[model samples]
Target: MTTLAVPAARFHPLRDSATMLRRNLRRMVRYPSMTLMLVAMPVVFLLLFVYVFGGTLGAGIGGSAAGRAEYANYVAPAIILMTVTATVQGTAISIAMDLTEGIIARFRTMHIARVSVLTGHVVGSVLQAVFSLAIVIGFAVLVGFRPTAGLGGWLAASGFLVVVTFALVWLAVALGQVSKTVETASNLPMPLMMLPFLGSGFVPTDSMPTVLRWFAEYQPFTPIIETLRGLLTDRPLGNEPWIALGWCAVIALGGYLWSRKLFAREDDR
Candidate 1:
């Protein structure tokens, strides 16, 4: 029995995680509206900015000749980042629902790997984020946004976005576990969605007031957006990419530790 138990424990982790991932994917399909709503917000913002506000903003950034086209190129990175935040917001909501609905309790009693439950959500959210990004980028292109990134740039940008998504998804998982209710989980990540607006996303940080500009320049999202922008537009990145990765590492580690603690507490309860 001891020999059997050791081998089962070793083998079950991957299998259990795969099973949980499938469960999450099925849940996503079962509830299509949530996915649509999550994807729609970023698309709406992209359209609103590029069409409604792009011309004036474009002139401010470059000149009147650049117009909406230039602004679309400039704002596309921010919109992409927003897409990731929106998708992870959904992850928090989903996690909260699982906890509140007693599915977690049921999972606790099962022989499955405990960590697999959270990993399922994390992997599923990342996939959803990637899908949403593709749709948003396609829309951006349709609206006159052009990126000059070569194959390597595109690959690097894709990898960077994945890392960002992974970090944010872990953070969302922790936020979800910390919430007492689904509504609270939904609200907790609200600040994340707002960060892009407050950072260098919509306009240059230089244009902000003294204090606001300082905050915008130092915030995690600013460097992240700038790194992505540099990759996509073939602009010189300087140090923003490293700063962005450092931020991601911090957030990911904090979130992972918090999540494990929370899950253990739940088990104790």
Candidate 2:
């Protein structure tokens, strides 16, 4: 008599992801200091930008025409963006550590779904980003950075920014997977993070040099920062909004493809 082997059916990926999320949440609860550090770093940066840099940048904040608004008002969105951007480093480093330390390999041996481990990290990062945003926004309000757009507009603006932040997460995930050392993933966000300052986030594009003006007008950060400002401050939604979204989409798609390639390569090794 010959015996034949039967293959087991694969479990649903979604169910696997749900389990990972529960595990991730439990892990986050266990490491309160880790969560607090991510939130606290951004809040400290916000303070530095608001007080130490404010007087130097001028009360107008990088020289905006809207003198009626305080410097804190102009820079609030930037700080919020920074909060999201900064946390990407933490996410990237954490992911790299897991991959390098063979923790990810250990997960592969488990009966639970493999993807959940990664998904959990992402969900946790998003939650942490949201908390950082809240911290920055709360500080902005406390410092008198009132948004003229009212509650509805503010929410819309925040939602837009969050969309950009989500796109950024894919890039971070990709980098984390590709980079060998935790340091590389940790510092990568700094270069991309400066795009906003070079664009309209800090100063008006028109007043900038002709070359910079062109870059500022066309770059993704200009549109995002401006659109966000318009949303928060009731300014007009310039072409910047659409342009910013386009840039984000392009980066997100590119980053996603590269990230997948890198992750596959690493796993095969």
Candidate 3:
């Protein structure tokens, strides 16, 4: 009698991740109001700053056009970054909600790739960030923010934004794992959203107090903002692109490792 050999099933992390990504994306589509609110907040900030504060801010920045145009150009990059920072907070809240609702525990019992679960949240958040960026930039153009970058520069700027979004979403994932409740997770990522204000996003670092300027110059968001501004506005890309990329790499790796450990510990429980 010949015995038949059974082939073992192959596990594919990429395929698993894609499936999870679809699941998360579907959830976003089903619950559209929250996403709309998230998009609205940044747009509100853009309108407020451009219309209300533009005259004084633009005059200070020394531009030739109407104050609105100059301020629009100056603030658009930072607002794009703000869109990213705001969008990632939702990732933290989603992950925390899953944990609280016992969804993650249910997932633990499934015979699927583990990282795929986290990848779903990360990819979903990144896509959301991209959409938010597009909305904000479209509004910026409508308000007279004309980017001087060529096609290659726009592509590079997009790549940079993707990296920043990936890093922050991973950080959000880790934050979610550590929080006891969804509310806490939602609140924890607030600092990430606020970091841009403390940096050179709104005003020139030179105009800040000596100590504040030092901190702004050294912070992670400042380089990212400067690099983005350089790419979009034809400003010299002086070392900031490399620095921002390095910062994103470090944050993403750290967050990934930390979240993995948290997930494993929770699973063992």
Candidate 4:
């Protein structure tokens, strides 16, 4: 009995996590409108920036002849990052739903691994983010955004984006857990969506006023956007990659610890 129980305990977490992930995926399908809303914001922003603002922005960065096509290339990476942020915002909403609906309490009474609940949300969110990113990138391409990345560059950028997504999803989970209501949870991550704009996203940081430029240069999202931009453009990446990784590591660790504590506290109630 002891031997059997030992292996069962060790393997249950993986099995439970897979089960939870399927549950989340099914929920995602059942509520297609939510996914569409999340994806639409980024696509809208991409269009608005590339078509309406692109010509002027492009000319400012390059020359007048650079036009919308050039601006598309410059802004594509930021839009991709925004897609990630937007998808994770859904994670917070889902987590809030599970918590407030007493589902989490019911799960606590079950024999399944506890952490699998959160893991399921994280995994499902990461998958959704990737899918949304593909759609956004395809749209960007349709609008004249061309990347010079080779196979190696594309692979590296993909890996980096996955890491960034993982970090943000975990953070969203923590935020969702702390929210008193679903509305609050959804609002908590709204600032994340604005980070790109406040950073070197739409325009160069050097082009901003002195104080704003300083803030933009030092912010976490700026380094991340810059690193992703460099990888996608096949440009020379100096230390931005390292700084971005460091920020992700800190956010991931902090979020993980906070989430575990919150979950445990709720269990004790």
Task: Give the best candidate by lDDT.
Answer: 1
Estimate the Cα RMSD of every predicted model relative to the unseen true structure. Answer: 2.4, 2.9, 1.8, 2.6
Worst 10 residues of 2 by lDDT: 60-69
Cα TM-score per model: 0.96, 0.86, 0.95, 0.96
Cα error of candidate 4 at position 256, Å: 0.7
Off by over 4 Å in 4: 1-11
Q: lDDT by residue for model 1 over 66-134, one digit each (tens)? A: 788999999999999999999999999999999999999999999889999999999999998988899
Tens-digit lDDT track of model 3 for 122-235: 999999888878888998898878999999999999998999999999999999999999889989989887888889888889999999999999999999999999999999
Q: What C-alpha lDDT values do all the predictions have?
A: 0.95, 0.75, 0.90, 0.94
Output the lDDT of residue 194, model 4: 98
Q: List the residue pairs that clash in candidate 4.
A: none
Report the lDDT tens digits of candidate 4 across residue range 1-269: 35554454443899999999999999989998888898899999999999899999999998877889999999999999999999989999999999999999999989899999999999999999988899999999999989999999999999999999999999999999999999999999999999999998999999999999999999899999999999999878899999999999999999999999999999988
Tens digit of per-residue lDDT, candidate 2, span 115-217: 5666777777777778778877887788657888888997897778778877787788888887788878778777666776787766667779999899878
TM-score, candidate number 3: 0.95
Query: Over 4 Å off in model 3, which ranges?
Result: 1-10, 63-66
Better of 3 and 4 by TM-score: 4
Question: Where does model 2 exceed 4 Å of error?
Answer: 1-7, 55-69, 111-114
TM-score of 4: 0.96
State which candidate, 1 or 4, has the greater lDDT.
Answer: 1
